[model samples]
Target: MGSNYLLSPYSLKGLQLKNRIVMAPMCQYSVMEKDGKPNDWHHVHYVSRAVGGTGLIIMEMTDVEPDGRITDYDLGLWSDEHIPAFARIIDGVHRYGAKIGIQIAHAGRKAEDAPEPVAPSAIPFPGPEYKLPRALTTDEVREMVRKFADAARRAVQAGVDTIELHGAHGYLIHQFHSPLTNRREDAYGQDLARFGVEVIEAVKAQLPPDMPLFFRISAVEYADGGYGIDHAIQLCKAYQAAGVDAFHVSSGGEGPAGERKPGNYPGYQVPFARSIRQALNVPVVAVGMLEDPALAESVVGNGDAELVAIARGLLRDPYWATHAAYALRSEEKHVPQQYERAYH
Candidate 1:
């Protein structure tokens, strides 16, 4: 494995990444206070990846409102008080030379701590712990779009290099985008792309023109009667038109237990990433069980994706990128000077 595309520099808008290896956002659910502010756990978790040589570190799904969180333990940006704490973490990651991004999201029908979760339809998530969601009025939906904009503004003020909207994993934006969850008869129903498009427009307004925007999407649902790749391509095109600069292609969080599960092999979602990149003509990130450096390299080398994200792999080894640079025979400069001798 030669030092190939995986270790190459990539720039989108004004953001420049040192390598194509990104630390995908994975929630810690460790917001010690019930107020949704990040704590020490998040700081160490992200900064460690920065020091390990990851090019971009996307923070976990941070909620826009108190009740919009997946759980009370999730991070948030609902108030100005939350700014300083996030700025501290961002500064730490930057100190180690890695750019940071935050995924802004709302849990919607899946909001575990909401007195009553809200959704486009009054459906219940298929689980005992989950409650039936109250359908949102058109006005409420518009308000949600506003909340997303405010959250993005707060994140920008906190000094993140980029903002990723968590439009996947059956969250609020995903709920509005999916036919299964968004059964509304009005504008959202007729146009599946309405909510997402509005959300993107709002977020972009709050960001500087040069700050790249990333959207994570479930490219294809895995259940019966669900949408497929074609639908995803169409939705992505709509999003791109709205304001997204890149797509983080992932799949299958909308289905029930036994359905079309995506392959578990390393780089299984690379094809989906490739399709989205080609169809939408934007940079895309391929993630999903890509623990092997060789496989990650191949995804980039084959032009399947511009970046590769490793989740559980990075959790198991924060230095996964540094080790990968070694495994791929990357330039010695990728290894931090103090730790360079250990690699040999």
Candidate 2:
């Protein structure tokens, strides 16, 4: 493949994506009044991106439990009532020739500003205003696993083509993987990978056999002795064996503010995805600061990753895929008919 690769179609477990560029899941925080239901705003927001020519639109992280939400306004998939709202959004996206995937997560100890947060340990986030999360009992941990499965089932019922497990971002799942947060002797906590493995298994059991499943993993915690790129490769291999379709490699979030890396440039995290892809046979999606269309295309062309996901860049211009297609000189890309007058 050349550096200026053309956008093309791809498939994941029977779900056909019209192109390689994907709109990464971004927190809209515009849910309907804490009910975690999508309303007209979400429909307009996501549908606009789809119509603007994104191949796949990964919806924002939706909490599997109410208290698991990152913010009170974040979306939720824990209840049957959320199905109708999501169904509308999915339907709208499909109409524009785009496939939609929902990213489901449990915020765990990182759940701040919510009514309550749960985690493997009671250790609170180090921030001054961070609230201490209640450590979950064995039974509670089991229940959280069930919540993830139930949420996946709900997403399927709502007509989503794929479901993504939000296991990164120092959330509940990442907490279990990080030695800094998960310090417990229980079965779920004794082994750092145990919690995440169980959650993936549970969610897989509930989803349809043909439904594509993806896991978003923090490729590096960026903290001393924290989960590193090598550990992430191991986790990717484990989940691929467990039947995950792809891995979304991301980094950062483990201990405190000092743990984060500043001065990020374009394609800063591409190496994480490349390393994971090289280590494991599973497909990988590269994210982070992938603003330029040509740079995003080079990631796939150079074998850095199988898919390129853009968040803020896509938000700045939803027609990024169309522009990327033009840059690559690929006529197969889907540019909305309405935008034809402007682009032509």
Candidate 3:
């Protein structure tokens, strides 16, 4: 990659990367153990992306607790035992010269199989399968912060490159972020950002000072009563003060499907990433449908975001980064030695 912005090296605190193409965290939901342990599928799926020349491989949402999972099949790091299984993938990705991170999350009301799901309030996700969640007690809210911290601790022990807090897509953290869902009268209710701030502080305490922290946010809600991009910006300001090194900017998961829908086009969410990056003066990762190499490159070249996340595109072609280098007409050859014959 001959100095194209997308192929350019980047760093955040102590985490350095050879390029800026980040594999956005996408849930595989393939854990066969029911015990929240990653199996071979997760291993091969992530390693392929690394060997294909991805700079960063952020694993899918791995809940901090069992009930925090979107499904029973998702990964979890609530126990010390879960560390080794994750270490396997982290080691593999590092071996291929790619840094790895895991998104720690809590599904909250979105928990599908929880006998009783929990959220900022008692609202239920809109569906027959979704049940109204019990509002977490104030004390319980404090405990959840500790849970997030513990998950971060295990992530560090597992030797991952970074940590991205799953604060988007209408999960537990999202429930707290949006006023549409958080209606309590307590301290958490006093500030839409209290929960997120606490979680950030708690997680940071567990991490080394130089380890970069990435946070994902749904910039706006599609629901008629949802929060706007501005609200998310303010929330991010608080998180930035609490030591978030970067943000993964995305939009909408709090509303019912198609209610406050965003435009279906490449780089539609780039504006959100740009806004947060400028306003907070921190690096942001732009995501959402940015599959085109030219568009992804422009996003970086034009200085919209520090990095671009490719989710579904990487799924279709694990070698998207290498191909992107070719398409961008860069001398950046990310091909592995084994694939050199084919590339040449």
Best by lDDT: 3
| lDDT by residue for model 1 (1-344), tens | 36668889999999999999999999898988788888888889899899999999999999999989989989999998999999999999999999999999999989988899999999988888898899999999999999999999999999999999999988989888898898999898899999999999999999998999999999988867778899999999999999999999998777583567778687788889999999877999999999899999988998999999999999999999888988888773466788878866
Backbone clash pairs for candidate 2 read none
**Candidate with more favorable, higher TM-score: 2 or 3:** 3
Candidate 3, residues 1-344, lDDT tens digits: the string is: 25488999999999999899999999888988789999899999999999998999999999999998889999999999999999999999999999999999999999998899999999999889898899999999999999999999999999988999989999999899788899999999998899999999999999998899999999988888788888999999999999899999999887675556787999899999999989988999999899899999999999999999999999999999999998898777589999899976
Q: Candidate 3, clashing residue pairs?
A: 1-331, 1-332, 222-260
Name the better of 1 and 2 by lDDT. Answer: 1
Q: How far off is residue 152 in model 1, in Å?
A: 0.5
- Residue-level lDDT tens digits of model 2 in 1-344: 22335377788777888888888999998876889998899999999888888888999999998889888889999899889999999999999999999999988877776666788899887786678888999998888889998999999999998889987888988888778788889997667788788888988998888888999998888666676777778777777777688999888776643555632798888988888888886788999988687888788889898889989989899787877777777766577676678877
Which pairs of residues collide in candidate 1? none
Output the number of the TM-score-best candidate: 3
Off by over 4 Å in 1: 257-259
lDDT of candidate 2 vs native? 0.84
- Name the runs in model 3 displaced over 4 angstroms: 1-3, 257-259
Candidate 1, residue 273: Cα displacement in angstroms equals 0.8
